[model samples]
Target: MESTSPLFALRNVTKVFPGVRALDDVRLELYPGQVTALVGENGAGKSTLVKTMTGIYQPESGEIWYDGQQVTIRNPEDARQMGITAIHQETVLFDDMTVAENIFAGSYLTRGRFGNLDWKAMNRRAQEILHDIEAPLSPTAMLSGLSIGQKHMVAIARALSVDARVVILDEPTAALSHHEIHELYELVRRLKARGTAIMFITHKFDEIFAIADRYTVFRDGAFVGDGRIEDVTEPELVEMMVARSLNETYPKVEAPLGEEVFRAEGFSHPTEFADISFAVRKGEILGFYGLVGAGRTEIMRALIGLSEQARGEIYIEGQRVSVRSPADAVQAGLVYVPEERQQQGVMLDMPIYQNISLPQLHRTSRAGFLSTRNELAVARQYGERLNVKTSSWSELVNNLSGGNQQKVVIAKWLATHPRVIIMDEPTKGIDIGSKAAVHAFMSELVQQGLAVIMVSSELPEIMGMADRMIVMNEGRQVREFTRDEATAEAIVSAATGVRA
Candidate 1:
């Protein structure tokens, strides 16, 4: 096998699973001393290619070449030993372990004839790596105590510990604050400066353009295009990924606004948000705009009864209601679609029909036993309405792709027949097509007199979909804007406390 003249390359890769071809004839290349971005919508085979490179999956037909030579990656360890490493969105660090321990988890330093663990040497090296990455933390600090950004740095340190020549970062800044994301960018630059081939994957085009040197696009499990970042525009890249120009990303519909349907007066969560007051009218989508730590999510959680100490008076249709738990809120005709679908929205192992019917099992059951026919009917109705792509209503929620899984979550909430639906980061990790679908569905729901309270960090969503928006900062509602008055500049300024 001759060296391919690139640090790493995947040629003509194909992977198949039951009822799906995850990757088909995908080609990708990573060059030393440069960052190559993998741009694609969810379920577009970007993840599959990364998995193949990391030894999680063997391609049906493909060749993985490293430093111009063909190689077989038997397992994760084999990939790591070959200098191909990945730092995923979720940091794989033990919470109970020290930073140094996490950095040198599987492979540890040893000394002496008996080969005893070398804690001092390991800690010193960990400190050096942390400093190199501009991470401010003690190597002896527990991983649990550090913030999400710091945990990511620990993952990077682990990659450094292995002397990784090729590094793949999958949505690394998904949970990072603006400042932390800039720090991560600097760290990536340092890695690239050291001649490490970097593969960056993210849904954010701004970040991709800012940091990536080259870009490769994939669509529907097939390679689309690859070229220098300077040679492609954002709109062009988006078209390549979704097979359509997203001229209207939001697809917000104009509907006649009705009387106030849901209102929260003096809503307060002791340590999270304070004095949050807002009213959402029927057929209107009230947007909540804020920065990462501005307590937008906490307010929604409180309204949905997730916060026990949430002090507030919630009124639906002029009558005050006491919401002490999720069930209480749902019974009040107010349902919440949580941001983390896998953790709070749906049960992955459960069938789609069951998940859809779980919230309203009492309505679909007779004498405490769930009526399978009723459940199926309800799931089928909402599934079609949301245009959820699935093998069948009996399929497990986890079997669906990220975008379809999100639709399932939305479908389950819609099945509850709530008058007021609160969505938190509704399209956080979904693809452009699914996002458009969800946005369109939201428009349809509001047009049908279903009031929606949408909490979002994406400015474009806030600007495009929101009829009116309330900006929060440090637990307080600072500013409110109607659709005509709201601008990205104004919203960001309010969210960051730069303007009052």
Candidate 2:
């Protein structure tokens, strides 16, 4: 395979940060019309390799090959010109711009004579691209008004508009629904039929097996293995991801749930959620399963007092509690780990110690002065417990990998010792190895008598970890399932309000 000529290839790519060697002696090949699935643990140098190939990062030592010819891509424009384009894990679209405007952003269509913007032609072209992808969205619609799945489709449309020969999709289905994911698969098939090579990066093994023709596994900044998708079992892939056999990924522990630790009654928030009610006991994990607009996040936000217009009765430890703000919720022994980790969870520019200690500043301060010793001690403790990969606690959070950054966020909350924790899409963009680590941590937390309310889109995670599950549909709790009773079909039916 290595001897065969590839349409696109990365030869011995290496990237280094201050103390971190992000990628080391890595190599990959993307054959024409083949979808290669990139798999690894978070921080396994997957992002670094992609960034290097896409011109977000210049490799310290390596060569990129296009059609058996060596090339150096210095910027995104250069990569695009060379028929390389990447759709990031996070959708990068202008919220204020229309779909057509965003699709043709830097290179807008111009009319004859004067260089006037050709709005009609641009919209028509955008509509044509969307039609090709089978996406149900208007070209004139504002990006902010679209769902996460819709935003993802728009990104794909943008990539297709460039007529890219090699398309890289990073965690494309992290926020998409089953129907939308099917649409994406169809689009990928069409692209492949047209002889376009694809590099797909995802944590979902099911999707990988479904769409990928070949697979590559990365571990700790190095390539471990690559082969045909049919040649590998799910367990084998899992072992390759973590570099070890995982005995039990979920590792459920039985703990007697105590009286209700947190309760919401008649919770209502306009446009977000309404008429939601549930109770979570100590030493229990209450998993919430829903589609993108099923009001899972809105309910969690209301519980943490992030929604101003939220109206409800919240009881903590059987005592009525009123949370008017985030501070109020924190004072009441409740904390929220937001879905957008970069925007809300941690301060990227700050050091790990500072970010970890931010949530509990008052505890680490003496008479309004922060105690550096206390901060460092706390950060080091949680960092080690979470297995955060870093040279030191003084390292910046942004410098760490996606999974390590997530650990820092969890460590920040754990430092505060909240009784009830609401986690929104905790493992959304993380790799399978880090995801298992997080699942283990959650199980441990519940065993230690902490109550957890987890909102997730992945059915397997919910079924495996939750003691009880609640399915939401369009802001309503349509069904509930015990750990023994929940199945993929049942959960999907409940979430989509579809009878089965």
Candidate 3:
């Protein structure tokens, strides 16, 4: 099997962007009737590779081979004509349009009577395609009422609208339920039996081991390795993606344990997560570790009242507190630093001082107006405390690097003087140096008797920084571990729902 070449392959692909060579002579192979798992860490050029395959971006120099022939795909239509299609996690589908209309949006079938759009014929074809794919969706039914999993079905139906040979699924199970995921696995098996090549892109190990025949790994924009799924273990795959061990970096300083500072009681979202509860003590780093769709971020959002309908009660220092909104959470001495720093963390266009003081304007204001002097003073203090390297307090956040920008966001929240700070994916998108700095700052924070809740996907980061850990799977708290008990093998198994 290793000696035989695949029908579709990308040879020596090189794509260069300004200040970054996204893909440096990368290679990928997709064979007919097999599922290939495309694995990588964040910013490892997985998305760039997908774009090149879909004709969304052309490689500066590379060869795309399909059906035993070299091909040139100048646009999306060209890719489609070559029997290539993709179904993204957030596929573009119109809610008001019928499933049939979405299936044949760009290339509508037309014939009969007045040579106009034959709705009847199109509906008939759509019904056939849906049925063929084992999708129990109505062709004439409106897409608005469909669930996320159903929308994925519609997306698959649209892909099968033509004679699709290669299908790319990018994180398609990120929002699906447990049952929906099972159904999706069955669909993948059916597709495999039909001789369709599949590229399954996800961060879940369980998905890869369950559905993939072969595995390809990319790290730092270069190909690491590829082999049959059964030949290697999960830890070996992780080692390929990380290219480093737990002891490579991360500075953690243990502080004396203190009393409880924050606690959650029975947190539940209607569709996201349920029955979630946890506690953080002063001078503690409580880490939440899970796979991409395990609802960790959703729980954080609900805690800060972003999900209005989510039911949850919170406590601070043994007293019940109201957290019905962001303001309420802050007022109760709790604050959240979101994972998406550019959008939810800081005001990118605003000056560093303004962005830092914006969240605490009420406290920094006098006579119903904010004083520029007070704002600058408040920003200067926290900025220096966090070691934020900026040209000046008046420097715009957009001008700073990703790490500095993250520091500015942390400074803004710290100015509010909260008891417990929730940092979601705190070091994401930053370099290793920046991550170490963040970890050092977290240690300093806990040493000051401030409770910190750090949510991260990196196993080493969680193990290095977390005094205690909770692993969630499919919207439920499946397991918990202390610093002494946390290990890469155990955490991955629990996060992937494998029985101990």
Candidate 4:
């Protein structure tokens, strides 16, 4: 069958920043009634291509064709005018506004003769859009009152309300549950049926096979592969994404666990979670498993001193420590890389060197005078060690790819030289190649006698890397398994409260 005419096409596109060519001679096509999966390793220019398509950045060279006609998308408003909309990985919602208000923030409906605002019409339309996405929400509901999943639904409703012909979803399911992902897939199918073209950007291979009809791979700011989903194996796609073989992606390491390095006893927090306890031995990796709301993250936060109402006895190196804040946790040799890297992990506006040295700034300074040379040395050492693909230490963190940004977060924590590292969803939303790199780094840390506690939602990841596994259900620990005992079935049964 002849391929359907592309609703949009980018030819010979090139985007350049001060010292970086984000995208070079990249070509992509989006067909109506089909979903295209955009795949690549971090700093491979996936985001840059998306930005160019969404009018966040203008290409230095090339043409964008929509409906077989050349078009100039100068701004986001222009893109929206042309029936294109983007739902970014990081949600952009007005927290204080109601769902309906946020849905029509920049463009609100107007009523009768007096030109008064049509609140009723707006609410009804918002409700209709939310219902179309299978989101259970009230138009009057406050954005601040919703969970991360709910907020994402609101964003989707807003996008649907625009009635866009081309929809771009950047890691939409990153923070959603399995159930919510199903709902999203249903909505996406509906959109496809209505002839909407979708550019689905994600690192989850399972999702690509499940939702995408076609695929495009990016490597080092260039197009590496493009074909139908059925024609590409997951391994082939991953290889194209990183431009390397999987066998060589991760480094080799073997850890020999020693005596207990840190312990949490009877940890509890009222709203977030309750009655959590775990221990990490030197040179060991303890994995935490649960659904999105299963208190895995809550317990991690409490253990890392990011929770205010948390009550627990934290023992580090056989000495009891009081950790009331992140600073306290760092003082106790406990470092946490938060889930939301952009918001909590790195300073997007700051240079890479500054962010890498943020946690250990005191170590690089004397008499209140910061030492640039020391900071540069530390940043360079860890940056290269972590394989952060950046042009220079002075490059802004935001300029790097999602995977590289994550590496910077890891680098920052490593600068502190912590005894115990708590990584919450460390590999979440990263490409397969980057995921393997992160896994290799975790193994290295364990071999170096650094106790690591990882909270992850991906079953395969937990099964592959964890030395020990702890499953949580409804705010309580349900089961523990050693590496040999841990399996996908066992972890799922324990996490879902189903007896095996």
Candidate 5:
């Protein structure tokens, strides 16, 4: 009972960026009342194609057809007017304004002879949309007062505000909790029922299978294939997206763990977490798992003194240490590679070698002068060791792909010679191939007597890589499991605070 023609279609679309062709005759078709899953690796041009669709960029060549007629989208305004809307991974919203104002920021309801802004109309409509989505939020509430999940609801309402016919959700569940993700799925179903064409872009295979009606694969910026979602298996879809079958992931290297290298005792924060304690041995990989707001990240931040109010006792190499700041933490042989790699990990504007040499500048200085030779040598050694692909050492950190940038951040910390390395979401936004490489490198690192504490939301990653696991729930350490004792079911049960 499906329509023969697509509601929106991009045919033979091409987009070129400088020397690179971002998209090469890529094609996408979104049928009415159907969810099309756009599958791709990290650099597979999904973002580029999205920009074209939302009119952020005009394609080099292609035809965009809507409702059986070709349409020209000149800018974002034009796209919005054409009923095309996008809810990006991190929706750009104003923090200072009310929910209603954020929803109708540019296109507000106006009335009267002078065409004044109609605040009452906007608020009422915003409240109606919020009610329909089952989001209990006030239209006049300040945007900053809302939680991450509530902010996602406002973004969805904004999409509906434009009467969007083509709704694109780009990694919308990246920051959502379990309940929030469920609510988002319901909203997606509601949109589909209204004959809205939805393009769902996500990397999670389970999500793709759960909701997608059709799947379109893209590899290296070109269309690989398209078919019904039920017609393809997970492995087959991955093969299409990556152009090769992936081996068993999480190549955990099992090495002999040595004496405890790092320990946290009575880790407590008044509002964030309470009574959290753990220990990691040298040559060991320890994983922390939890849903959002589980206080895993809060504890990590406090470990390195980002949270001044956090009280904790940290011991390094069997010696009591006082870490008042990240600098002190580094001096105590403890370093953290933060989760927000783009924002907190690497300095995007700096060159790769400079970013790598940032932590250990004293080692790269001779006679009170920065030694470019030594800096480049340190970067070269680690880049080769980590298999970071780059055109040149002088290239800006922003120019490297996600995997290579991650390498640069790790290299920055490795230069510091820390006894314990805490990696928060080490492989969060990178591609599958890069994930394998990072995993292999992590194993290699532990083999050299380094203690690794990895905090990840990915269950498979935690299960596959960690020698021991710790589950957190509602800002408390709920359960601990050795590698032999851990299973997906038991771990999830504890992390979610289920009494089974």
Candidate 6:
């Protein structure tokens, strides 16, 4: 329930960077016991706003008010002192430290004449906080031993230690499992019961609708709208974030399946996946559906020769091939577009053209030297094809937005001209428009007789774009479904090992 008076407020805030206006005259408010969701696409002002609130970056203009009193937070310590703190998607905990130590790291409890550390009191308080949240965690346990979800629980316990009134969670559930997410929801409700004001920054609409009481939307470094969650629809929220009414989020194009292009027989990783037998034909999109630990990505990695000791008999165009390394896989007309595009797919510091032309250096070179003209042409060709929004071909991959960087990754893979292309989580962190573009591009690829294998956690994406799909559960292929046969329930059941 929202109170008449806001617990914290950001009024007319403006923040600017060297080349961009990160935030522009943005206004936001959080009331006691209310869960306020901050919704935005990647590169929106949400991050800037969070930084400003958490004292990471001071606003060039405007004011911050807490409990009806204006305040200036010079650093993170000041923000924490004022009952403001945040938990990021990545848990920040020292591996060598215990849960209790991490919870009271900086603000340690001291006692006795010599002012020695009071570990007993801190451990007791940590246990109380953990019990309050119903988290089954030991305060004396090493932080390194806990799972990702447990680490987040410890972070929440830390917030309670500081008596946090305004707690900002930035993509907290991004890496959490379904069960863990539910646990987090229960913890959040407990926080609300204690009159804590929560500011949730996330791109997931499902989570927003599930937990948020009030909603605030931001677009292009400006405040777009704010309202009660029940008052707004998903499409309306999408419009607010992307500034476009995307009638069709997935542009799936139907194409006739051609002759078999690639096949894997009894592919097995010692511990990852076992006897994964599947085949993809030319002009077909094969979707791999599974939970996080269901071996979807491991199968792809093994297919691309990234997993050592992976045993599989691969066939390309009915001929047996040995994939001993990534080069061998490429030579055998197979390429993988990895999920971690920033770390593996694209060279972040390199120019867009260089990243695009990297795999095609042989074709883009005359003798032993590379041809700049050929490089630029290849980059321009796929850049235009993918509709990458960039200032110039020389723009560094790091400078591009998440969606555009994904485009660059796809363009680089397409440049390889692989017969079998494996795309892992192709649109994981991109916006709807970019996702549609990538979907359309996949359709185009298959239409041109290029076999595609797509590994995705998003059910809607798999159902929308895949011609055929397979569900993996605990290192095994459990079931197969055609586009018409795959349902949310069926796929999820198969992925979770529920024989339905």
Best by TM-score: 1
Candidate 1 lDDT over 275-314, as tens digits, reads 8888999999999988888999999888988898889999
The superposed Cα distance between candidate 3 and the true structure at residue 48, in angstroms, equals: 1.4
> Which ten contiguous residues of candidate 6 have the minimum total lDDT?
242-251
Scored by lDDT, model 3 comes in at 0.88
Once fitted onto the true fold, the runs of candidate 5 whose alpha carbons sit more than 4 angstroms away are 244-246, 399-401
TM-score of model number 3: 0.74
For residue 390, what is the lDDT in candidate 5? Answer: 78
Clashing pairs in 6: none
Candidate-wise lDDT, in order: 0.90, 0.88, 0.88, 0.88, 0.90, 0.90
lDDT of 5 by residue, 1-500 (tens): 77879999999999998878999998999998999999887778988988998889999898999999999999999999999999988889998999999989888899999999999999999999888777889999999998777888898899888888999999888878788898889989988888899999988888999999999998889999999999999888878877666564578878988999999999999999999988999999999999888999899999998998999899998899999999999999999999899999999999999999988789999999999999999999887888778778999999887878998899889888888999999988777767777888889889999999999999988988999999999999999989899989999999888975
Rank order (by TM-score, best first): 1, 5, 6, 4, 2, 3
Q: Could you tell me the TM-score of candidate 5? A: 0.93
Candidate 1 Cα outliers beyond 4 Å, as residue runs:
1-5
Cα lDDT for residue 455, candidate 3: 94
Off by over 4 Å in 3: 1-3, 113-115, 246-254, 263-279, 286-324, 337-417, 423-448, 453-500
Per candidate, the number of residue pairs that clash is 2, 0, 0, 0, 0, 0
Report the alpha-carbon TM-score of model 6 versus the true structure: 0.91
Question: For model 2, what is the alpha-carbon lDDT of residue 275?
Answer: 90
- The sequence of per-residue lDDT tens digits that candidate 2 reaches over residues 1-500 is 22245799888988998877989888999988889999998778888888888888998998899977999999889888887888876788999999998899887899989999999999999999998878889999999998777888888888878888899988888767778788779888888886788999998888999999999999989889998898999989989888666556666677789888999999998787879999999999999999888989988988888888889999999899989999889889999999989999999999999999997888899999999999999999998889998888998999887778888999999888899998888887888777878888998888889999999988888888899999999998999999998889989998888996
Evaluation by TM-score, superior candidate among 5 and 6: 5
The candidate with the higher TM-score, 4 or 5, is 5
Tens digits of per-residue lDDT for model 6 on 472-494?
Answer: 99999999999987889999999
Angstrom error of the Cα, residue 161, model 2: value is 4.2
lDDT for model 6, please: 0.90
